[model samples]
Target: MTNAIQKLYPSTKMSIVLAVILFTLMMPGYISQYSVFPIFIIIAFISGVGTKFLSAFIKSIFVLVLFIFVFQCFLIPSDTVIWSKGILTLYKEGLEASLLMTSKIIAISSSLIWFFLVTPIKDMMFALEKAGFSKKFTFVIYSTIQLIPQMKKLSQTILEAQKSRGIETEGSLMIRLKAFLPMLGPLVLSSIQQTEEKVLALEARAFSATVRKSSYYQMSKKPVDYLVISVIFIGFMIFVWWRFFK
Candidate 1:
């Protein structure tokens, strides 16, 4: 059974995420942008996917944000030097820019990550189809979203198979690198084979037939969805006024 938040319409969840992205873009200062990150964590916990959400965030976006911060601090040129040690120098301007950029990245990425974590991909595609999206468009969206998780799963399976075969996958960095290199060949070939199989399966199912498709699953927006969307809109407008007019 899904929780209340997870049970909400995909469109509703998408709108909430879009609002977060918009706010991150429009809001000034590091504090506001960084504030959105924790809000996503709170939402993830409320939705009962906090552990998965944090694991994914740490493995992906956290590393990317950290890299951007480090690169900007060291590489970007500026007259105002904040810190220096030996050949390394940190610029005040670069640090400020990095904070702003990384904060936006975190807010935007976390919102999206939270949405996908809470909402299943199949349900999202179904909702898009209900919202008048073409099947082809929805299929592309579904495929793109599923690609990463699918690849990750496949890689893990292959790694385990290698380990079972007495391959040295868990050792020094060089040993792991060697193990990983062999896995790449199999991974790529397996991915291609899976794609062909999927294509054949789609054809067998008349996926491209010029006929209408019907689904048994029905989804509709509830009153609470409207209430939540309204709250988000009101919050957005208030932020806009405060950001620009005030």
Candidate 2:
């Protein structure tokens, strides 16, 4: 996380921002098609205007969209509305497939951005507490979220180390997959070792104490939280009304 980001979100605020961003992004999937394009444009604007994490999320969106296009063009059931160009016919059924896939692609992209960048991991856990989660469960959830990025980087390091040691299985496609075994085993072992160390450290600190703990940056739902949440709820209702009842 950038220092700027850290300073901006003292933990709780980041989580609420992330949650709202995700909710707004998913609005397209839950409503009629009339709102889809407009929401898409808004999300695109968000991504485009962002200086950080924008390109990565955009690249992910493109990858998903391109895969969807391939699947729709080649795998969907054929129909009579095929565009016949000499020997090739592009089926109309593919259009529906493409739209569905596009929806999924955009939704997933938005979610990744909101959760990974817009929200800090600490803030996410804090928000979970506000949502009535038990402290123990929230601790575990927060730990896991923090662990993932570390784990990914560790896995990459392990893979590179194994590759450097001439652990080459590059000939056959199956052999290439089997090569992952070397990396996976070491990574899992490393994770276990790290977990054991963490457990001991937690135990030393009396982490399992029954006494309640107070938060320095306490997460209380302010008037803004309620006001923001209410606007979202009402917007959702109105969206549904316009979609189904209009």
Which one wins on TM-score? Answer: 1
Cα lDDT tens digits for candidate 1, 74-157: 988889999999989999988999999999988999998899888877788888788778888988887887698988898898
Write model 2 residue lDDT over 1-246, tens digit each, in one string.
443333233233334444445454545543333344345345435544354445765676768777887678656658645666665556677866677557655654554554456555666666666666777888888878778998899888887888899887588888798898898998888778888998889889888787665566554555665665666567766766775687
lDDT at position 64, candidate 2: 71
Cα displacement (angstroms), candidate 2, residue 111, comes to 5.0
Count of backbone clashes, every candidate in sequence: 0, 0
lDDT (CA) per prediction: 0.88, 0.62
Candidate 2: segments with Cα more than 4 A from true spot? 1-49, 151-187
lDDT of 2 at 204: 95
The residue-level lDDT of candidate 1 at 124 comes to 86
Tell me how far candidate 1 lies from the true structure as C-alpha RMSD in angstroms: 3.9
